[model samples]
Target: MEAVILAGIARRVLDELLRNPYRTIELRSARNVMAVEAALREAMRLFLTYDPFEDVSTGTEGLLAELMEAKYLETRIPWEESDEREVTICRAKVKLVGLGRVVEVERRKGVMLARVRELFPHEMDIG
Candidate 1:
């Protein structure tokens, strides 16, 4: 039996093209090759349900690998010891994890850049 699927239908049609003389064939038949056209309609219904973009809206192939593993270099403060505020610098690039997307939030002081996700390896040099 050969099953050929037609257009716009999820079901298939079976046809017996060959006849056997020495063997008795009732419900059991053999098919060489069959084409599935209507099966696409049903398969598409399942694919569209769960897509890769459910979490991430966009994903670019290459983005310079901006974030990397690094260590906090130092903290720079402008005020005096009594009421001093500190700034932070990392040794190398920082690692970004669990971030669906990467986008530059803002830049400060021309040299200071902040990212959307928090820096990993939590314990970093702080002043």
Candidate 2:
């Protein structure tokens, strides 16, 4: 159950980081486990808002289980900041839950930098 919550938080954080407009994001609390748990709670709150019909009584365990079975479970964490101090490398430690194996997916700084440009190509071109 804790894994499920952590996975959800990682997914949400990664998603937000990917979409972040800043060229460099400074996450001072990235290493704190309690901060991570707080992020999980916030993500869960956001999820509940999207689907008001979902039963709150069933809790995150059931909801996360459903997401896992549907193949929608993926997570990412800020693994390291670049030596050059230019980019942050986010890693997906748990690619899939309930698969009986741990799959790692590292999103390098170069890739994420390219992704940000891809997201707003016109803006980059204008500058």
Candidate 3:
């Protein structure tokens, strides 16, 4: 479930990164895992605006599955940042499935959201 929650957080930042194209370096600012989790929770609550208590698939991974199937996310990576230097990124890229096309996120949010667009382009919109 952590995946779902993380995905949501990454998505939120992705939206922002895509909007300006200059925020690509913001992903390196995540200080810890807890911060990532918090960002994910915020994304789920604010953007999704769904109650976890009411939904059975409220787990982090569960949420990610829904978003992927719905064509929301394109890629995700599990990494840790401590030096504030953009040279330590080493997480593998995970593809987030859309409704019709397959989009791979080259760099995920918080730690790598600035490159989401270069990583994934809008090829198909199933919804």
Candidate 4:
């Protein structure tokens, strides 16, 4: 089923995000970016991944709505005023589960990117 595939992709993204928390990654292509976004949406509802990053990554509740409204603003600067245009990475924010944090995601050159900015240590009982 499509839902199953989406859920799986979402879990993978969450795992990768926690695996290297706070790090911004530039995915291979736009398709990859869309995959991540779609997965986030699906994960918001059914968080099936709960490993590595610990308990906080429990696929939090109501994260989908936040991500849906999250601002997607960007500035573009073309390398040349021609058909071939190159611009800076596009940026946006999305509330992610597990860390219970809003991450900054970027897209450029048909690639996807995101940075897990903050993760409350208290949520993980770090202190």
Candidate number of the best lDDT: 4
Per-residue lDDT tens digits for candidate 2, residues 1-127, read 1222222233344334335422222222233223223334433111111111222222222111111111112344445654443333332221221111112212232110000101123322111
Better of 1 and 2 by TM-score: 1
Better of 3 and 4 by lDDT: 4
Q: Candidate 1: what lDDT?
A: 0.20
- On residues 7-119, what C-alpha lDDT tens digit does candidate 1 reach at each position? 11111111111111121111111110011111122221100001112221222111111222234334557667736465444232212121112223222222111122222
Query: What is the per-residue lDDT of model 3 for residues 1-127, given as tens digits with 9 covering 90 to 100?
Result: 1222232235454444335432322222223233344434444211121222222231211112122111112233436644332332212222233211112222245431211111124442211
Candidate 4 local lDDT, 24-96, one digit each (tens) = 3333234534544554555422122222212222232111212322222344555566664442332323333
- Pairs with steric clashes in candidate 2: none
In candidate 4, which residue pairs clash?
Answer: 56-98, 57-98
Ranked by TM-score from best down, the candidates are 4, 3, 1, 2
Model 3 lDDT vs. the true structure?
0.27
**Predictions in order: lDDT:** 0.20, 0.23, 0.27, 0.33
Worst 10 residues of 3 by lDDT: 62-71
TM-score for each prediction? 0.19, 0.18, 0.20, 0.28
Winner of 1 and 3 under TM-score: 3
